[model samples]
Target chain A: MEKLFYFSDLFGVAVFSITGALMAGRKSMDLFGVLVIAVITALGGGTLRDAILDNHPVAWIRDDTYILVATLAAVGTVLWVRLTRPINETGLLVADAFGLAVFTVIGTEIALQHDTPVSAAVIMGVMTGVAGGVMRDVLCNEIPMIFQKEIYATACIAGSLVFIGLLELGVAAWIATCLSMATVLLARLAAIRWRLSLPRFHLLDRI
Target chain B: MEKLFYFSDLFGVAVFSITGALMAGRKSMDLFGVLVIAVITALGGGTLRDAILDNHPVAWIRDDTYILVATLAAVGTVLWVRLTRPINETGLLVADAFGLAVFTVIGTEIALQHDTPVSAAVIMGVMTGVAGGVMRDVLCNEIPMIFQKEIYATACIAGSLVFIGLLELGVAAWIATCLSMATVLLARLAAIRWRLSLPRFHLLDRI
Candidate 1:
């Protein structure tokens, strides 16, 4: 079970790192900038989860492998994107969706381990899935997609509920995790395909 | 001593909030964005410190007044800057310097209260002084000023050391806090004037 979880984490890291490197490439940043964004995107979400839980020796600092994998993935992506100008945006979105799904489940699992309530776990899951992308967007000087596109966080929340429901139904941990990831991926992809958006409050108009 | 520290924290929040609003104005962000950035810049560092320490009911969350003041300051600054198109960049810099000094001391003091080691406290102090700006820059989609500029973090480090040394010498808390803040302000202003930079590692080349 633990090994399965670890593998999922590694997969998520690679996907997020590639996405981050692609973002940097879009900006035509130097190699250093690409590496920085990639590493941050891969590790930022988990780091926040650990810190909030007061888990000592943050995830990346404890396991150097995560950093190593992210760096390699980032460098490779940068080179690939450079060699092949105009990488497919659709492909990147699919990868990002996969990363978001995996990370949301992992984050919820970690929060549950810490004995956080279901509500807290759901919030943490959304935070974990979105934070890395938010950090990447901020570094790239773009408005975070999370704030503008409510579907991003909304998908994570939906997945968290599915995970909790599966657990209540006595489903095995692995099965529950897989189902949660699938839910998030499906929801996110659907939203993107249909351009679904939450109702904007438009406080400005009210004022 | 606690009273003085609270006062310093209040002042720091106001100063940083103003600076954040000013930066938002420069970017031509809407008033809502300006307010968000201001509150984030003012409270972000302390919120991070508290979260890392696992202090429940985050500082700003517990004390609504802090959020109110930061919001008011942000709104006022945005309106002021809008009315006065030719903003005074120099004045904002000076206020930011003062904010850095005060925030550094407040952060170090909080760490000390938690009985953290001197080295840890120093690191926390620097994090508290700079994390908000890093966050602001990230949200603005720019490389964090901390990564680009040397003097910013350097000044915090120097001030933290002075704070620790004063404690070792049995200096009064209020006096030590004042001296440390002064040191930070002076070092930061000088660095900005002289354009100091750390030697870039350029790890990519080695790799």
Candidate 2:
């Protein structure tokens, strides 16, 4: 069970790293910059979650796999972009949403392990799902996706709630995880496909 | 001695929160946004530091004063801005630098407590000093001050090294801290006064 969870986490890291490399490439960041954003985008939110929960040494520092996966993914993305046709935007969205869903479940479970209250646990899950991309976008000098009327964080929140609700109803851990991840992934896909988004709050209109 | 340090830490939090609020005002963010940015600007770096070090319960969570000071600072800045004339930019710089210098020393000491090596400690110190402001500027969708040609992070690094070096020489802790903070503050002020800056790295030209 632990092995399976670890594999899913690495998969999340890999896909997010690729998305990060894409952003870095678009920004004309050097190879080093590309790698830095890759690591941050893949690890930033989980790192934040662990830190906020006071989980020691952070996952990446304690285990080298996360960094290795992120690096390989980043390098691969850079090479692929240079050698092949441009990446399809839809493909990137699917990969990104998959990563987000995986991260949300992982974050919620970690929060629960630390005995955080249910509300805070769900918040941590969303933070875990959204913060890495937010950090990546910020580093690229763009608005964070969570603050941009995107359906991203909301999907994570809904999924986390479902995960916790199921656990309370005696669902098996793996089953709960899969269902919750599906919830987030499907919601995000629908949002992307239908151009659905929450209303953006803007003070500029009044001013 | 510990009480004095706590007071200074809170002072840093207060000043930085004010700077954050001022930035929020300029960006036309709503009141909630103003408070959020203020808290992040004041506490974000130290929170990152403690989390990285695996220091549990984080400083702010251990005590309520930091949040209280930050909130008061943010609310006060907003009121001051709306009720009085605009904040003097020079004054803001002084206050911001004060927070940065103090935070650098505090972060360095904490890293040493965790037994990090000298080089890593200096890096941690710089992260503590500059990260909050960097987060603030990024949230405002602007280039971070440290990443610009500014001497900000350099000043923090220099000061942190000084702090550690003096401590290794058997200097009293308080004196080492005061001298180090003075070093950063003075260096930053000089950079501001003389308009000293480093050359920026631009890949666009080479590419």
Candidate 3:
């Protein structure tokens, strides 16, 4: 179980790195900028989660493996894009959905282990799933898509709540993890397919 | 000295909150958005720095005073702007410089206390001084002003180095702090006045 968890975390890092690299490419950023953005997009969420929880020796700094995976993934993305046709948009979206699911579970589990309040744990889970993408969008000089009406963060929130609820009801840990991850992945993919989104905030219009 | 440091930190929070609220105002964000941005701009830098240094119970979480100051400052700015003429642009710039100076020194000092390597300490200092603004700019859908032809981060780097160097040379703690803060403030203000900037990266253009 531990091994699976670790590898899935690395998998999340790689997928997010690809998304980040593609965004940097769109901006015509140089190789250095591409790598930096990719790494940040991959690790920024977990870093913020640990920092908020005061988890010592943040993941990448402690293991170095996560950083290596992110760097190699980023470089590989750049080479593949340069040498071949652009990656399929739909494929990238699916990979990103999986990444988001994995990260949200891991973040929630870690927060629970640290005995954080339930509300804080859920927020940490959502932050873990989306903060990296937020940083990536910000660096690319765009409003974060999550804040823009995408059902993205909503999926994470639902997954986190389900995970916590299942655990509280005495479900097996692995079963809860798997079910919750599926919840996020399916929700995200369905949203993408159907163009679903939360209603846009229009506080100013009302005022 | 501790009391002085504490007050200056709160002052920095207030100034940064004002800048954040002002930026949100420019975007015509509603009150809730303005308050959210202001709090983030005020606290985000320190949060990142402490997280990087593995400093536990992140400053604001350990004490709610910081959040209170930030909230009040944000609301006050909104009220002031609504009731009066627009804030003086030059004055806001100067206040931001002071906030940068204080945050840099505080970040460096905290890192040193943790026995972090000097290089990491310096990086933390710069992160503390500017990460919030980076986040603020990103939220507002703009490339960070610091990244785009501004000497903002350079000033933080200089102040952090000066602070560390003075301490290494056995300067009194208070003197080191004061001189370093002044270095950042003066450098930033001068850069603003003279439109100083680092040469833009043209890596792709050259290739």
DockQ of each: 0.11, 0.17, 0.15
Q: Which of the two candidates, 1 or 3, achieves a greater lDDT against the reference?
A: 3
> Candidate 1 on A55-162: residue-level lDDT in tens?
679888898999999999998887776687666779878888988998999888887777766666775687688788878887787877565663777788899999
Candidate 3: where are CA atoms >4 Å away?
Answer: A203-207, B1-55, B59-134, B142-207
Which docking class does model 3 fall in? incorrect
Which whole-number lDDT from 0 to 100 does residue A47 have in model 3? 92
lDDT value, residue B147 of candidate 3: 91
**lDDT, candidate 1, B1-207, per-residue tens:** 787777677878988898777666555555545666787789888879888766655555445567777878887776664454555667777888988998898889889989999999998899899999887877867778788776788999999999999998999988898899999999989887888778887788687
- Evaluated on the second chain alone, the candidates' TM-scores are 0.91, 0.95, 0.96
DockQ of 3: 0.15
Ranking by lDDT: 3, 2, 1
Clashing pairs in 2: none
Give per-residue CA lDDT, model 2, range B52-152, as digits (tens).
Answer: 78787776655667777898998887677666555677987897788888999999998999899999899889988888888899898987867875688
> In order, what lDDT does every prediction score?
0.81, 0.85, 0.87
TM-score of 2: 0.61
